[model samples]
Target: MQLVFEVCEVADGNPVSTVRKVFDGVGGVIGRGSGCDWVIHDPSRLLSSHHGLVGCREGRYFLTDISSNGIGMAGSCERLRKGQARLIEDGDVFELGALSIRARLMEPVQPFGEQPVITGVPIPDDAFLALDPLQALDLEHQRQSTSDELEALSAGVGEPGAWADRHAADREQVAMPRRVEPANELPRVDSGALASPSDDVFWMEFAAALGLDLGKLDHVARKALAIKVARLFRLEVERLQHNRAYEEQVRLISTLHSDYPG
Candidate 1:
């Protein structure tokens, strides 16, 4: 599948032409010329000192910042630090310097129980053909007229009356205060005050109860078991605290009673 990208300049708002320029430049670097099937660019060099990589790999596209400056991912568990390759997902927001790029993941539609087929269409030679001479002349005239109007407006501002008005406007704009929303507060945890058993101790007791040989299991499997046991214990404690009867509790109690034979 062809990797899709949406690019924009850091200083300007989303302009289609500017985005197209960056995409086209980067596409030439990796897509058409390089043997590599992916296109990745460090956009930081263009607008800011920050550096990042944007590319696709094995049907997945990602934008990661690995510069001295950092990139922030909105609502993410962790801020992507330098040299960190964060897996991009649909609607993922990446902030690099003053610019933000939002990833819009597009999945190819496949027939039920079927793999998606990639299509390659050849470009037509006529696509690059120039416009008629008269049409080109008219377009040039329009552009010159627009430029002249802009120059006239810029020249008019040099007048005393215009200069004074412009200065006052600039001052007023600077004097206006911007309103900002308060940051969302996180829950405060006092680690010193909380009494919680370590996972190692709990896992040892749980493994003893289950009669499992810890030495026989791999480290990954043991960690998985510890997590599962911890979750199960937490669920049982919550149920008992709420005075709820759970079948697992009854089964455990019956098993213990049978072992004791009392």
Candidate 2:
């Protein structure tokens, strides 16, 4: 079975270098000798290593404080104390300073009707038979006694006392909600002053009846129309000025010509 492992931090946007150093340390432990095929280490890029060798082994995966600071796996069942060998299982999370690495166990597939055989592995004869039942029972009794004591301590805690009530009252007296004034609304514009619907409707209907071909109207035509409109407006203003000047000149010339008549 190929295992999948991921390394991330509690804080977002951690540097790639920190992630790499973690993989390097993990690689050193499981990447030696024949285990090279079962371990991978790279931190520069994600998906850097392929195959099933990027994670740590179950029994062999151990944590150490090689870093200048220290590393810890928060919320772990085994309680990974400083420089301790905490056995890693599938879905186990370990924190190395800010870095957090999660392990996922992959299930191994077996062929049908094939009874699995355990061979050549170190096995001690009478390993299970060597247990002392009386000693085991004593340890179990001690565990139960400890659990009962914890429950009793938890049940004793109840509502706050007089001191807590006084503190709460003091805190309430110090703070109060401020008043929020109403905001001034903007004055509305008069709808009657705006252009009427009839004005727009007439122009729209006239434009529709003309069947204006928008595609046929290119940049040149638009430019030409704009120039013509500007020129016409300028000519009308010029014509008014010219008429006024001509009227003044004619009045003066008539007066002069009349005065000098032979």
Candidate 3:
């Protein structure tokens, strides 16, 4: 049976749930013990070391609760015990101490939100391809096709002319980076000054401004995406905390621009 562990509750300092596959097979264990196939992470000290076991027999999924504390199952009045192997089906939610994960046969359902909570980013449908590194950075960065690069791929390659042109183009891009509007300049950092955009403290501040608790996020990539999305929200908001947040956002945008430049 396919199952996913959706974090219904997070303990203090717990990172947010990462999009990951915990188990593929039918048999597994859910406990605090290291030997268990799926180690239970309980911050409340509620679950015992050997808590529960999951297995499949006759194409039916079942869970055996062995902990001193009862294991709660959805739609069941009474909890399952060691002797009683509770039948698990799709939409089944299992509770082990403070953490409860919903089990399903497919991908975990996205949480409810007015704006789509984007967990995955699809490739651009424009089908834009990059032939060079600088061209990849800014698609609009106009350039003429080099003859040597073409010849190199086809036959004995072009002369030293091709290599020289490519090297020159790279230098030009660095010398004069195209900037956009007011946020063109990257946030400046000074010695012993306040936290800069590149510093970890800035991101922490950014998260706080956006109400993003880093401890609630588990995956690094998801944490990065959260920051990106939060900045996108910051760009649109007219007021924050009953006051104009525009000034703070300009500084925030400076940092954001440093990370993502056109």
Candidate 4:
């Protein structure tokens, strides 16, 4: 199942910029922070870093207010306080911080979007063989010689695992893959900062928090999860950048970390 959240910036009773995100299974977070999927830039500082959540359960979509200031539901007299969740319907309008968002229910069919068609040149028959019989024989002999040489080299290398172990030191000498890096490379947040993009540890922490087994997920699932994580990271980064105070930044990290059950 999939759910769509069409978020629009409201200014003077008029809509400004709009962002649309389609969430799968687990749904996503809404906030002023960089780590949220639906990020609202609240200049009035009326929203929490991690404000609310929109998720689906048992085919029913619900909205949960996790923000300190609470969330306003359209046609409702009172605000939905922290920890309060309500079943929401399609076309429902809700207020978070300075922005307004509309909820939309979607069917599972073709939820993500249409895939591109990839066409390739077809290989012709006898493409690999030389046109002349004598030249073909010569080419066959050259291929055999190369195969034999590769087999000999393979035998000398012993088992693949053993060869890898032997060259471990040499591999270490090479530059690290451009993924995880030292915490120092990230924005300062007291003792540590939120992990930057491509950081393994940061992603691991996020996966753990979401009760996700990344190793068990297929490529498509992983890609979706990565997109969600990127949104969250962006939300957090925005929060840190918006709030220059060191103590406030540290508190923000502590708040988010403490909120995670895992």
| The candidate that achieves the highest lDDT relative to the unseen native structure | 4
Kindly list the per-residue Cα lDDT of model 2 for residues 1-262, writing each as its tens digit: 3344466553445453323223321223222112223332333222212212222332233333322234455574443443344455667675543446676545545576696876795634543343468855765575577677775665323223443454567777886778989679887765433646874564345323322222333444534544643554465466568779999999999999999996
Candidate 2 ranges beyond 4 A from true positions: 1-3, 10-12, 15-60, 76-79, 107-262
Alpha-carbon error at 38 in model 3, in Å? 0.6
* Candidate 3 lDDT by residue in tens digits, 131-221: 3566554432322353656545644222134454555666677755667569577887644355345756655675444333343333454
| Residue 92's lDDT in candidate 4 | 82
Off by over 4 Å in 1: 1-3, 7-17, 20-50, 75-78, 108-262
Q: Which ranking of candidates, highest lDDT first?
A: 4, 3, 1, 2
User: Positional deviation of 164 in candidate 2, in angstroms?
Assistant: 99
Query: Candidate 1 vs candidate 3: which has greater lDDT?
Result: 3
Model 4, stretches more than 4 Å misplaced?
8-18, 108-262
Cand. 1 TM to true fold: 0.28
Q: In candidate 4, which residue pairs clash?
A: 33-235, 34-234, 34-235, 34-236, 35-232, 35-235, 35-236, 36-232
Please give the lDDT score for candidate 1: 0.49
lDDT of every model, 2 decimals: 0.49, 0.45, 0.56, 0.66
Q: How large is the C-alpha RMSD of every model relative to the true structure?
A: 26.6, 35.3, 24.8, 17.3
* Strongest candidate by TM-score: 4
Per-residue accuracy of model 4 over 79-112 as CA lDDT, tens digit each: 7766656777878888876667787887877535
